[model samples]
Target: MKRVVVGLSGGVDSSVAAYLLQEQGYEVIGLFMKNWHDDSVTISNECPWLEDSNDALLVAEKLGIPFQTVDLSEQYKERIVDYMFNEYEKGRTPNPDVLCNREIKFDVFMKIALSLGADYVATGHYCRKGILEKDGEEVYQLLAGVDGNKDQSYFLCQLSQEQLAKSLFPIGELTKPQVREIAARMELVTAEKKDSQGLCFIGKVRLPEFLQQQLQPKEGLIFEVDADSPVYHQEQPTFASQEEELAYLSKNIAYTPELGKVVGKHQGAHYFTIGQRKGLNVGGTKEPLFIIATDVTSNTIYTGQGNNHPGLFKKALFIQQPEVHWIREDLKLKAGEKMEVMARIRYRQPLQKATLFQFEDGMYVLFEEPQSAITEGQFVSWHIGEELVGSGVIS
Candidate 1:
């Protein structure tokens, strides 16, 4: 029998995944990843790792599979936590869950499983894998889950062809409700456990408090720019080429203190993000104010009156050449070539129609409709039909 290592995350989905793999006649081993250790930052009584580890052990015992816990705290801190702090310090929002899957789970954990004579490593992610033949070579495809409402292909966007080759997503074909039902039948300990809402493998966190741990607070002024500000009335300039036009459209508007009146003050500009509406604490506006820009260098926060503010939307976004990742290398675009694809900048977002343009320096994704909060340091994934072809960090 082929050997498989399942990342039994102490959740209902993973529990069901282990059971299904066992029924398929594979020699399965359960491994629960302990990715975090600092509970001081996590909310009290949340889904702590101890509870999760114990539950994973119970599931493994019930399934009659050998199990162990892998402590990846050091790697997680360096790869995901440190990177998150660095990004936020530079006024950019980083997706740690995506990073966790890429750096820790698939890279580090997969290597460990391979050393143990496992042919594949499985997870409970709500995404599917497909195989295609191209030029007599086997090509792997990362397809969206059958469950539209629970599709999680966006989180695995950074996966490569080789990574996909050794990965298995057993619950991808089942919806959330179906997985729950299976777990109920199996009487898994996690059958009724609520899904974790915090960072991957880490419990729920008070973000501001978490950041405050390392990022010292500094008072900053918050300015509210008007919808009709003169900055938005700039005359359109003629573009020399399509690339030039895309560059202009994707450019972020610079904000200065003089752009608007001071509405309030914030503990730190780095704590906020584009399109954020909460934690402002400022009141008395005709409409609720939303964060449009944050300048860490100046420690200033810029806000717009409402969600409809033009500053919050962009028609295009650029991705540096080094940052672009292609899961399907065969379908990569050549320089001066463009392809129509569906793309999303954040997880759980509905796919939007976009065109991908490749140039010598980088790639640009121009959307059919303006997108809000095209924040830097976030991954933007592109798909063709149900297969995720490529992804890149927004520049």
Candidate 2:
């Protein structure tokens, strides 16, 4: 029997995953990942690591599988926590969940499992894997889960072909409700447990408080730019090439203190993100204000009056060549090539129609319609049908 290592995450999905793999006659071992230990910033009663680890152990015992816990806190801090601090410091938002799956789970944890003679590492992610034959070679495809509402293909967007080859997602074929039912029938400890929130391994945290631990608060001014500002009324320029036109469209609008009036003060510019609406503490506006831009260097945050503000929408976005990642290397676009694909800037966002243009320097994704708050340091994933072909960090 082939030996498989399952990352039992102390949740119904993972519990069911382990049980299903056992039913398939594979020799399964359960390993709960202890990636976070600092609970100072984590909220109370919010999927604490100790509770989660215990639940994972119970599930493994009930499944009659050998189980253990892997302490990956150090690796998680280096690969994920440090990166997040650096990104936020530079006024960019980073997705820790995506980084966690790529840097820790698939890379570090997979190596540990392989060292133990395991044939594959499995998780409870709501995404499917498919195999295709091309030129007598086996190709792995990262397909969306069968459950539309719970599809999590976006989180695994950075996974490489090699990682996908050794990975298994057992619960991808079932909906959330179906998985819950199966766990209930099996009388699993996590059967009625609520899903974990906030960070991947870290529980729900008071974000501002957490960031404050390292990123000390500095008072910053919040300026509210009007919807009819002259900044948004710039005349379109004729471009000599398509790349030139795209470069203009993809660029972020530079905000200045002179462009708007001071509305309020924020604890820190680094704590705010584009499209964020809460924590402003500024009231009495006709419509709620949303963050449109943040300049950490100047410690200034620019806000717009409403969601449909012009500053919030962009027609295109650029990705530096080094940041581009292709799961299906065979389908990668060459310089000067372009392809029509469905793409999303953030997780669970409805796929939007976009065209990817590859250049000598980088790639540009031009959407058919304007998209809101295309933040930097976030991943943009493109899909060809159900298969996620490529992803890149937004520039």
Best by lDDT: 2
Candidate 1 local Cα displacement, residue 9, angstroms = 1.0
How do the residues 16-115 of candidate 1 rate in per-residue lDDT, one tens digit apiece? 9999999999999999999888889999889989998999999999999999999999999999989999999999999998898999999999999999
Per-model root-mean-square deviation over C-alphas: 0.8, 0.6
- Residue 78's lDDT within candidate 1 is 92
lDDT of each: 0.94, 0.96
- The sequence of per-residue lDDT tens digits that candidate 2 reaches over residues 243-295 is 99999999989999999999999999999999999999999999999999999
Pairs that clash in candidate 1: none
Model 2 lowest lDDT segment of ten = 36-45
lDDT of 1 at 245: 97
